[model samples]
Target: MTREASPAQRTRALIIDAAADLLAASASGEFSTREVCDAAGVTAPTLYHHFGDKDGLLREVAADRFSRYLTRKQALETTGDPVEDFRRGWDMHVEFGVANPALYNIMYGRRIEGRTTPADHAHAVLVTMMRDLERAGRLRMPTGTAADMVASAAVGVTLHLIRTRAAADDHLSALVRDAVTAAVISPPTVPGAASVTPQLARAAAQLEAEMPHGSVGTLRASEATLLREWLTQLSVLGRMAGGAPS
Candidate 1:
C-alpha cells in the first residue's frame, strides 16, 4: 500500500524544490526569502510558518541535498581494501563539491549550530573507515587523528577547487590525497619485518581494536579498560615516533 503526502508536506517540498532550483541557478549563491516565496508561490507568513526563518530554510535545503549525496556514497561498493575505499570516498567528495558548488558551500562553508548536518555524518563515515584501517594494521596514527587530517584536507581541497573553478584538476586532488595518505598509512608489513617500532605499533592497534569491552577469560572489566588505554597510548607514541612509509 502507498501513502500520499499531506498538503503541508507537499507545500514544504514545493518550497524546498523552488529554493534548490534558485540556488543552483544563482551565481553568488545568495537568495532572499522574498525570492523564495515568489518562486514557491507561497506567502511570506506561510514560508515563515513552515521554516521559521531564512537561515532555517537554507539549512533544510543544504541538509536535503547533502543527504542525497551521502546516499550515493553509501551505495558505493567497497573495494575490500579500506585504503582504496577511502581514496574513492575522497574523490567522490570532491566530485560532489565541484558538481554542486552552491549546495556544497552551504553544507560545509558555514556552521549551523544546534543541529546535525550531513557533513557530520560524512565525517563519522570517515572515522569508521579509519578504524577499519587501524584494525588491519595499515593505519599509522590514531584513528581520530587520521580521520581529522583526511577530512580537513579533503574539505580544503574541495573548497579550493570550487572557488578556483579548477574542478578538472585531477592532478591537484591526487597530489594532496597521496600526501595525506602517505602521512597516515604504513607500508604493508612483511613477515618477520626488521622494523620493530612499526610492528609494535601495528600490534598495539590491532589489539586495541580486538580488546573486549568487559571481562573476558581471566581479565576483570577494570583490567580490560586499563589495558585498552595502555594499548592506545602505545599506538599513539609509536606513530608519533614515525611508522613505516606508505
Candidate 2:
C-alpha cells in the first residue's frame, strides 16, 4: 500500500523542488532563501522553520539529486567482472556530473562535513567493487586505498568538465579511468598463481578494512563480529596455504 506524505513532508518537498529548479536554471549554480520561498509560495520564516537555513535546504537538495543519479547507476546489470564494473561505474559518474553540473557541484565540489547523504552509498559501492576485484586476485592495493584513488580521479575529471563546460571528450573519462585502474590492479595470474585460498584471504582483508570505515549496510554489529572472525580464519588459512605474509 502507498502511504501519503504529511503536511511537513509535503512542504519540504515543495521547497526542495523549487530550490532544485532554481539551482538548475542558475548561472552561478546557487540559489537564495528568498528565491526558494517565493517559488514555493511560502514565507522566509517558513523556509527557515523547515530547513534551518539556506545551506541546510541546499544540502537536502543535493542529497535528493544525487540519490536520483545513484538509482540509475544501481539499476545497471553487473557483469561480474569487477574491473569492467569499476570502469562502467566511473563512466556513469562522469555522465551524471555532466548532465547536472549544478547539482553535482553542490554534492561534491565544495568540501564540507557532518552531512548525511547518499554520497556515502556511492562510495560504499566503489569499495565493494574493489573487494570483488580482491576476491579474483585482481586488486593490486588495499581496497580502501584503491577506492580513494578512483574517487579522487573521477571527481577531479568530472569537476573539470563541469567547470570548463567543454564538449566532453569521450576518451577523457576512459583514459583517466584506465590510468587509475592500471595503477591499482594486478594483471591476470597464471593457473597455479590463481589459487582460491589467497583470493579468499585478500577479499576478507578488503572487507575487514572497509567494514570499519564505510557503510556496511548488509551486516549488523554482532553479525559483523562473527564475519570478521571468519574472515580472519580465511586469511590465516590462505597465508598457511601459500606461505605468504598478508
Candidate 3:
C-alpha cells in the first residue's frame, strides 16, 4: 500500500507550499501571518492553529526547505570513482533544483532575504563524501581560511550562473560541480577533490557554529581526519591516472 501523509501532514504541507510561494514573493524580506493567510487561502485562526504564529510558521517553512534539500541529497549515492559519485550527486541537486526552483532559492539563492539555513541540507552529502575520501586517502587537513573562501566563491559563482540563467550555464547542479571542481581540485589534490577537506571543513564549521555547541565537534574531527587522508590518497591516484600533475 502506498503511504500517504496524515491529515495533519497534509495540512502542514499545504501551509508550507503556500509559505514557499509567499517567500518567493517576499523580495523585500517581509513576512507576515496575514500575508501567509492570504497566500494559503486560510483564516488567521487556522494558520495559528497549525503553527503557533508568524514566527512559528516561518520556522516551519524554513524547516521544510531543509527537509526537502536533505531528502534530495540522501537519494544520490553511486559506486565507482569518487569524482563520478560527486557528479551523480550534483545531477540530483540540479534535478531537485529545477523541479523545485523556489525551494532551491530558499536553500541557496535567497538567504539574504530570508532565514533559511542549509546545514541540514548539506549534512548527509558532506558526511558521506568525507568518509569516502578518507578511505581513498586523498584528503587535506585544516581546511582553513582558504578552503572556506574558495567554497563560498565556488557555490556563489555556480548559483549566480544558475539564477541569472546564463547562456553558458550548464544544468544548475552541473554548474555547481564544475565551479566547485575548478576551485577544489589541484595537481596536489585528489580525484573527487571538489568535496575535499576545505569544502567539508566549511560545511562542518558552518553547521557546528549554528548548533548548540558540541553537536558537531565529534563529527567534525572524524570527518576532518577522513578528509585529509582521503585527499592524500586521491592525489596519488590522480597522478597515477594522469589526472593530476606529477
Error of 2 at 109 (Å): 1.7
Off by over 4 Å in 2: 190-246
The candidate scoring highest on lDDT is 1
74-169: candidate 3 lDDT, tens digit per residue: 665567666666556555555555444455555565433334356333643465564555456433333343245434544565556556665323
Give model 1's TM-score versus the native structure.
Answer: 0.75
Q: How much is the lDDT of residue 206 in candidate 3?
A: 48
Instruction: Predict model 2's lDDT versus the native.
Output: 0.78
- Tens digits of per-residue lDDT, candidate 2, 141-176, equal 799998899889998999988888854456777777
Task: Say which candidate scores most in TM-score.
Answer: 1
What shift in Å separates residue 147 of candidate 1 from its native position after superposition? 1.3
Q: Which stretches of candidate 3 lie over 4 Å from their true place?
A: 1-7, 22-32, 39-41, 53-55, 77-79, 94-102, 108-116, 142-154, 171-176, 182-246
Ordered from best to worst lDDT, the candidate numbers read: 1, 2, 3
Higher-ranked by lDDT: 1 or 3: 1
TM-score for each predicted model, relative to the true structure: 0.75, 0.74, 0.54
